[model samples]
Target chain A: MSGLLDVEGLVTRFYTEEGVVKAVDGNSFRLEEDEALGVVGESGSGKTVTALSIMRLIEAPGRIEAGRILFRGEDLLKKSEREMRRIRGKDLSMVFQDSLSSLNPTLTVGAQIARVLKHHTRLSRRARWRRAVELLAAVGIPEPAKRASHYPHQLSGGMRQRALIAMAISCNPKLLILDEPTTALDVTIEAQIFELIGELKEEFGMGVFLITHDLSVVASFCSRVIIMYAGKIVEEAGVHELYAHPLHPYTRGLLRSIPPLEGGEARLQSIPGEVPDLINLPPGCNFSPRCALADERCWQVEPELSGITPGHRAACWRAERPAMAGGGHD
Target chain B: MIVFLSKRLLLAIPTLLVASFLIFSLVHIAPGDPIQVMLGDFQDPELIARLRHEMGLDLPLLQQYFHWLGNIVRGDLGISITVQRGASVTDLILQRFAVTVELAFFSLIIALLIAIPTGIISALRQNKLSDHLSRIIALLGVSIPNFFLGILLILFVGVYLRKPWGAGGYVPLSRGLLKNLAHMFLPAVALGTAYAAIIMRMMRSAMLDAMSQDFVRTARAMGIAPADIVRRDIVKNALIPVVTVIGNSIGYLLGGSIVTETVFRLPGMGNLVIMGVFRRDFPVIQAVVLIIVVVRIAVNLIVDLTYGFLDPRIRYGGER
Candidate 1:
């Protein structure tokens, strides 16, 4: 499949007061057109950094050191700020977490959506407003015309998230990056949001880069999943393939830790150690210290991501060995 | 909205009443006798006692208070005791209050003009050379008091430059708006600079907070121009706290204008109050202080209403 977005050797660093933090170190991945790609990692695993780097939204003390961000075969890094401004919300859009904070507090939800249309489209004010209401209704908000005039704080959490989604999809962007869009939402609302996102992706034919720590979310929504640890992607495979036979130790740990929701033993499994400090990551492999199967060679030299099977890749040295099959989905 | 306005209006009555009582008691307790000040060098004790009786000071404190309060309810502020002998306090205040109001209005305008832009620029270009330069200017503005700044303006722009407009004097707007503004400009600058500095600092911090908000990032991600994000989102959201600061500082502004007007020799309320204090004009002092309190209360109410307007989540009168 032709890649809609290809990120190659992306290195994003933050020069904080403590030290240099390699937040997203040498991350490489691709998103095909009309495909949903999942990026799974814990809190400090640089998943958000990767998405922000793609948007070129990194602020002071944080810089994208080296990378070629190719969007539909066009190098995005070469674009100036002005050029990027035009491309954003038209060609690329992002739905951030924390809907309450993501939406502007002062402006009405309708005005906020209309603002995006005003920037990207040639519609008149009335048409822009009508489109805003249409988008709200599309995202499943009740009484779109009435709700559009309400401020963010006046709306429920689910409604606010829906409004944010509406705004992100206002211009029918080619690529939509959702950064843990359901983290602050309840489970029922989370399912609804994912369903809405799925429908929107189908309707608009847009590529989605879904970033979350929820493995189940990735399993249910993303076709291809990439597992990251200490800012490096350690495993990449189709969702079913990865869940069935996780090649990397970290991925296996993550899969084992997903508690069963069926008639089985309720013992919860957790990865043994905390994520390594990004500023002073362990040598060889960032995950080697916590890796249960790491050997002397694994401690001395880092392993590259090698093809384990036809469409699966893992960075662990033991991928060649027979896969242990206990963590398969029920 | 009607319910809210009426509630606020009802609340203001007791507030003004309490303020008047406090003003009368505080001014009376101060170490001065208005009759003695009025009858300077008169050695007749009977005449002094008679003057005190005539002014109602010979009665019990509560009785005198109630008598004054009763007259206030009837819309008579009594006669100025010394500053302008036999002039009605209300008339004296009415004449001078306009000047103070005008000064405060122009000074506030100046402050807003200086603070809003500087604050926005400082925040947008944070840590840059221009931001640093603005910080230095704000520091200077805060450090140098207004009266001292007024004197400096007089010396440099008025005396040294020999510019007639720079000298200290009052020019009523009735003569010429241009001349009046020129006459008021120096004092307004002096009075406004410190407040501008205060507001500028608040704006910078508020803008910084607003800029870091998720909405700003969303705006940027929406392909909105940087200028539009700042204008539509950052400034409007940032202004909520800054408005509170501005509203709360109105009292301080009125107090500062007292000194500012004195230095500029403007016949404002501040000049009236200062002259009254020195001459023990009890009626003028009480009336001016009461008027100031009322104005402050009204300003605070307006601020609350404006808050409702600016933030839709803050609903007045139970309307969702």
Candidate 2:
């Protein structure tokens, strides 16, 4: 009853040409009903895979190696693809990043929305059509009925995103997976998207597994946050707790990377180097090669995720006494 | 779309011109004189030389090409070197063209009908028993030469089935439609096999790729059924690529079906060209080659237009 979604030790990999990419290593988290949890990381930090894995949308060459995706205490991984399809768009749904490409270009938005209502709910044609318009309006699409008749290509990017949001929230699923849902928009449009997600969450009581590479979005919108690096969770804590006392160096690096508005200039620090390639990953801590405090222990054996606070976890040898950062330590 | 097409067309012009020149020059280049070949070796040398000179073989190669090009621009293809009742090359072209067109057209229909569904099913259940079996079938279709397949089909359907089912021979669609299909089946299968493999492989891969796209995943996530996913989402997205392969294969269908046509004793352009080549009927060969070239060019133009229709993103005017 307490946790609406409990994911533990989720592991995913892909047999790619380069090698077997350990895209998502062991990671665990929980969300209360209607709670918004943010997953933050740079590109290739297992952020998208974790979101896709949650949606059960990981394609061939990539699969759920081992994991327990418990949705309201039921193991989702064990469900048949058929049963999973039933839950998708009803019990759980995902809002993908490429909003324009994510929509079927040939299908009218109304028909697309009507399909879910038809499949998941026993609504009459007229009633479902009415509900589609309402959902479109709820997502702030102007001229709901008129715009609904248009194909995805006819709508602007922002409108297409809203359509996707409308579709995701159509069934009022228990969990909504948003994988950089606002990444494709401009800053001005980005604000509108965040506001939409916020409004939709309040209107419909549902868990939101919001995946994004932008730390600022997580800082502003997420109740709890998980910071990942090199396919594994490096840090997890309540948003305020992590912001007040960031434990992992990678977390500290990421927070420092974000420039503070109305204040610091050279304070923002870009973490040196990219996310380590998952294929042929280094021994010990995957982040050790990039870590400033890499030592014999950090380089010899991997640090297990250990509790730094009641619920906050950090996988670092120096988790207890990590250096504090200047407001914008660029 | 226009930019891609203009570039392709600009390239095609040189190609057609070259093909036309080659066909014309082929008559002159052959060891025997064209007039002698037409009038036979018994004709006097002076009359043979006079006929060749009149036919313009005595002109320079470049002059011959320019004269041919000029005539082509005026909608004229010179008289046939050997033919009945003094029919112009163009007239003979029109007369024989229908039979070839009908054969190629029927073969193309057979190819699409067999290939598309097989490809879809193969992709939908990839690596399963049916899929593996389909792969085997498609492989056999690919490996066995089309002419040989055509001969077998004639034996089985035309000879064997005809004995049991009644005497078999082609009835044009304009004739009794049902009987026409029955008569055409052997030739169609023979001509269609090569293209069938190509279409099947392209469709299967394209369908597989389309099924993996986010839009299709979104479609399924929206609770659309699997069959509908294939029809609406997967196959639709897969078409642009599939169309390209199919368009290219049509050339093989029309021009390359020569062996199949010969085996089935069908009167297609392939058979015409083969006969013309052997008998040294210079004008017939030239006319047939030119017509095939033009048909290929026209088919390509249609394919280009089709792209714009299928995807609005494709602009036929220019890159802009």
Question: What are the per-residue Cα lDDT tens digits for candidate 1 across B1-320?
Answer: 99999999999999888888899899889997888887778858999888888788899988988988898889998899899999999999888888899889988999999999999999999999999999999999999999999999999999999989898899888999999999999999999999999999999999999999988998998899988999988999999999999999999789999999999999999999999999998888988888899899999999999998887778988866
Candidate 1, residue B181: the lDDT equals 90
Lowest-sum lDDT 10-residue window in model 2 chain B: B163-172
Q: Which residue pairs clash within candidate 1?
A: none
Candidate 1 local lDDT, residue A271: 90
After superposing candidate 1 on the true structure, give the runs of residues whose Cα lies further than 4 Å from its correct spot: A323-330
lDDT of each: 0.92, 0.82
After TM-score superposition, what is the CA distance of residue A167 in candidate 1 from its true location, in Å?
1.2
Model 2 lDDT tens row, A122-214: 999999989999999999999999988878887889999999999988998878889899888998898998999998888787788889878
Error of 1 at B262 (Å): 1.1
Model 2 chain A lDDT-worst window of ten: A321-330
Give the residue spans of candidate 2 off by over 4 A: A13-22, A65-67, A123-134, A143-146, A149-154, A262-267, A272-289, A293-307, A321-330, B1-33, B53-78, B88-91, B155-175, B315-320
**In every candidate, what fraction of the native interface contacts is reproduced?**
0.83, 0.42
